[model samples]
Target: MALPLSVLLVSLLLLIAVPDIYATFHHGVHHAVGSRAHHRIVLPKHHRPKFKPGPWKQAHATFYEGGPGSFGGACGYDDVVREGYGLDSTAAVSNVLFNNGQACGACYEIKCINSPQFCKRGQQSLFVTATNQCPPNYYQSSDNGGWCNEPREHFDLAEPAFLKIAEYRGGIVPVQYRRVPCKKQGGIRFTITGNPYFNQVAVWNVGGAGDVVSLQVKGNKKLKWTPMKRSWGQKWETNAMLVGESLTFRVRASDGRYSTSWHIAPKNWQFGQTFEGKNFK
Candidate 1:
């Protein structure tokens, strides 16, 4: 009962004409397995876009008293105006934007939107430096006293900054904000603290991408660079015995830019004294 030769040849031709089930088609063209269509493009996690560029994001803003002695907040930026931030142009951001104090010295342009009644008539926007953290009050709901809670972006702006964009009575106004380059006057400033064996430095008055990511300290011209760990907020500390030596610092900003300040501190520099160094563009 074997098939005839002609029938067997026709069946073999039909099998060869059949298409593959897994084949990818484009423009009615069938591509077989192992073609370029089967390949995928993958990007590294660090290379992925973290935020959209040039887009204003939604957030809430309220005013806070920006007194002389009470200007500093969680980021330890004491006396913001004295640290080169202009008068009343400072804010305490919510946890998300604060990014565990990495957002310290980061400048932002904020404006009241969708509320014409409260928004200023001709003022464009207001620039403010992130000087503190608006901690979330978990006792209240997100819309109430917990405005700074997780998943919510809030800005506790200085009273003057808020007034520039909205009326004082607005209280909490809906706003749009975007990160902007910090326009600092002079160079980066470092305030040295801590004991002789441990040095805690508070960095401020930074320009460009103001938030510092990595920092290294060289005790003097003869010593190698030693990396400093972030103690808290913008304060970086090192346990090296760098007492009585002129100090130089290499600072790396969040934008991956680096700046080196050579021998900015004198050997006789006091613990309470602040030293100015080179800054980023």
Candidate 2:
């Protein structure tokens, strides 16, 4: 039997309301059908985030376009980007020491910078002997990735080597040398502690790098480091040299096999003292 007038009126209102509510549903179903027929895009499981083109020519870019999100690459997500800073597996300069003690991903993400992706080529990272602290003149080692000098480090602080005025008139008398008060270039000085040859006060490395050691007097022009006296490590003591501000500096001790810090500044800057047994390393 045909519906009554009132029933028919209600049915018409329901039909009108259904179209508006199901419009999006119908559209989505048709779109899916068309996409499948044309093989334009796969289903949800296979769908990928639309990737932008790479080779981003922007200033200080972070993420590159058209790169995979979950692939292990050397250049893109290495320790530099994920841990420190630098290009993707791009050959990192061994001399510059970057800050790594901070939090990771706390800064920019990989692909954000035009870093290497380690896809075509593998990764290259340093194996610093210790943490990330670097030395003077030299920053990071080119190979091992720790404290290193500019070239093949040729330095040492041996006796008979002159400081302010080389020639000493009196016996192993008391002398004075200033402390490296600056932050960038620090210095160390000390009195001749051991006379290896009985003629020259000699200091050698039994570990770390080979005979790559050099010494110098500390001053503003000499080297710079933490200016605070407490940071100097030890209270710089004087053996023959009496009074304050005396130090003996040694650095760049590398033997090619086990290269490491020749000597670390003691608790306080002191002369006539020697640091041994893998202290620097």
Judging by lDDT against the true structure, name the best candidate: 1
Candidate 1: segments with Cα more than 4 A from true spot:
1-54
Write model 1 residue lDDT over 141-244, tens digit each, in one string.
Answer: 98987889999999998898888889998899899998888878889999999888878999999888778888899976555799999876799999887777
Span of ten consecutive residues with least summed lDDT in model 2: 101-110
lDDT of each: 0.82, 0.26
How high is the lDDT of residue 29 in model 1?
58
Top candidate, metric TM-score:
1
RMSD to the true structure for each prediction, in A, is 12.1, 26.0
Candidate 1 lDDT (Cα, 0 to 1): 0.82
Total clashing pairs in model 1: 0
Q: What TM-score does model 1 achieve against the real structure? A: 0.78
State each candidate's clash count.
Answer: 0, 48
Model 2, TM vs. native: 0.18
